[model samples]
Target: MGMKVGIIGCGSITKFRHAPEYRANPHVDEIVFFDRNLQRAKELAQQFGGRSVETIEELFNDPTIVAVSDCSSNEAHHINTAQALLHGKHVLCEKPLAISVKHAEEILKAQAASGKKLMVDHNQRFTKAHQKAKEIIDKKELGEVLTFKSSFGHQGPESWGVDKSNATWFFKKERSHSGVAGDLGIHKIDLIHFLLDDEIEDVHAFYAALDKVDENGKPIEVCDNVVCALKTKKGRLGTASFSWTYYGSEDNSTTIYCQKGILKIYHHPEHQLIVETKDGAVIKYELEPIQTNENQTSSGVIDAFIDCIIHDKEPSVTGQQALASLKVIEKILGENGI
Candidate 1:
């Protein structure tokens, strides 16, 4: 039976990634969209060959919706996802699960009570390079992963958001809460967690609103840059930086130093994964280029979500997994006085 899906927000994420991906999924028969701005929902519905519902309650009450994608802002994820789960619909929430760890737990609790699946769109985990890297690491090719550094940065969301305006919700503290840290850093944190199969233990961070400015040329209220020193539960140490002021090409790169070798990810244009062994051998694996706002790629996230629902398997990026990353983010923000 074909499944019907609901999208909770008609924001950039919904327009660029989730809505299109779901429309392409064979298992998804229909899509219903709901947004605070009814016009936005109607526009996405028209563009994606779906229908717009006036209210979230209306969308959730529909018996046909088997699952929902909570593509709302960081602050709305908890409420939207929890309500969906309560309505007996599986939820695939976007990154940073929530602005706070407490909110993330609330969604998890709702999922537990409803006995429904709750997935998170930490899309980095589904990338070809990261998948291949995980396989190599699991085979002991790296010989005891020791330490790592990862970063995710770009020009800024102003150029990437749907409206392409500095006045977007991303710049607002109430909506986004933790600027670049929550926007880009959290992805790397999730990537490290996925690759090493470990959780972060402690974090010391420095964050500030470095460069981005509003129409009045005032600095943005939220941090535009964040750099953090991190330690894993297994005692491996690392550093990470998230920024909206790269002012150059996107740099979503990571390097893992192990006992026998160093694994460089996204370090080269042609080679997505590079290994330099202590024995002085170099191995390079060319993989697909990373997806950006302009250069779209199949994230494999929506497909995975659909397949998991159809086959009754657990999603690769579960709510519980995301909660761990959120906790680390909370610790970082707490330390930095965010």
Candidate 2:
């Protein structure tokens, strides 16, 4: 029998990545959705041919739902995901995992007590180019990775939110907590860890609420831009930046300078992954473009989450790994006194 899963939110993530991916998954036979805004839930359910629940308790209590996706806002992830795990449902939570490391740890403790799978959607690692890059770095084929620079930027969440309006919760400090640092920076932090198999040790960051305005035409409470220097446990150093005011094209590029060569990711439109060796040889892999607010594609997170459930295997992005990344984000924001 196919698995039935519940999604706790009906936001843009549920609309774009989770619901559609679950619909396409052969293992996922059914989906149930619940949102604070019941109408949004109904609309998404109808869009994906799923059922909409009026209350969160309905989704949690349904025995048919073997798993749940916690796509709620950052602040609600701790409560929603922990409760889902305790309810005997495996969970796939969206990125940042939690706004604060302490809250993330609380959820981690719940996961340990529940003994069910808990995965986070750090979807950048699921890319074929990124996976291939990990292979090269792991094998030392590119020699020792020394230093790097990575960034993720866009026009801002207003363009990507479900309502497509400036009033989106992404600009609220109470709701978003770390703003672009949590939204975009955490992905690069996790990606760096995934590529180098190392953890960030120290951070020095600067952030500002430069451009975005809230629904009331006031400056956003949270920072829209962040630039930081990071040092890993393995002594690798790197610089990272996150922005919601790029104003031009989405820039999700990462360039790693190794001992023998340089690995450039998303730097070229056609050659998504490029390798430059000291011998003046260039290797290009024409992989699919990275998915953005404008360019939608399969994220592979839902498929992987379902595979882990069916096979009784560990999820690709575990709760602990997510917590580690959340810690890094916390360190970055803590630097800025946010």
lDDT, candidates in the order shown:
0.91, 0.93
TM-score of 1: 0.98
**Best by lDDT, which number?**
2
**Model 1 alpha-carbon drift over 4 Å, by segment:** 335-338
True-structure RMSD, every candidate: 1.1, 1.0
Per-residue lDDT for 327 in model 2?
Answer: 90
Deviating ranges (above 4 Å) for candidate 2: 335-338
Candidate 1 residue 312 Cα shift, in angstroms, is: 1.0
lDDT of 1 by residue, 1-338 (tens): 78899999898889989988998999898899999999999999999999999999998899889999999999899999999999999999998899888888999999999999999999999989999999988898879899999999999999988789999788988999988888998899999999999999899888889789986788988899989999999999999999999988899999999999999999898899999999999999998998987788889999999989888999999998999988888888885433
Candidate 2 weakest lDDT stretch, 10 residues:
329-338
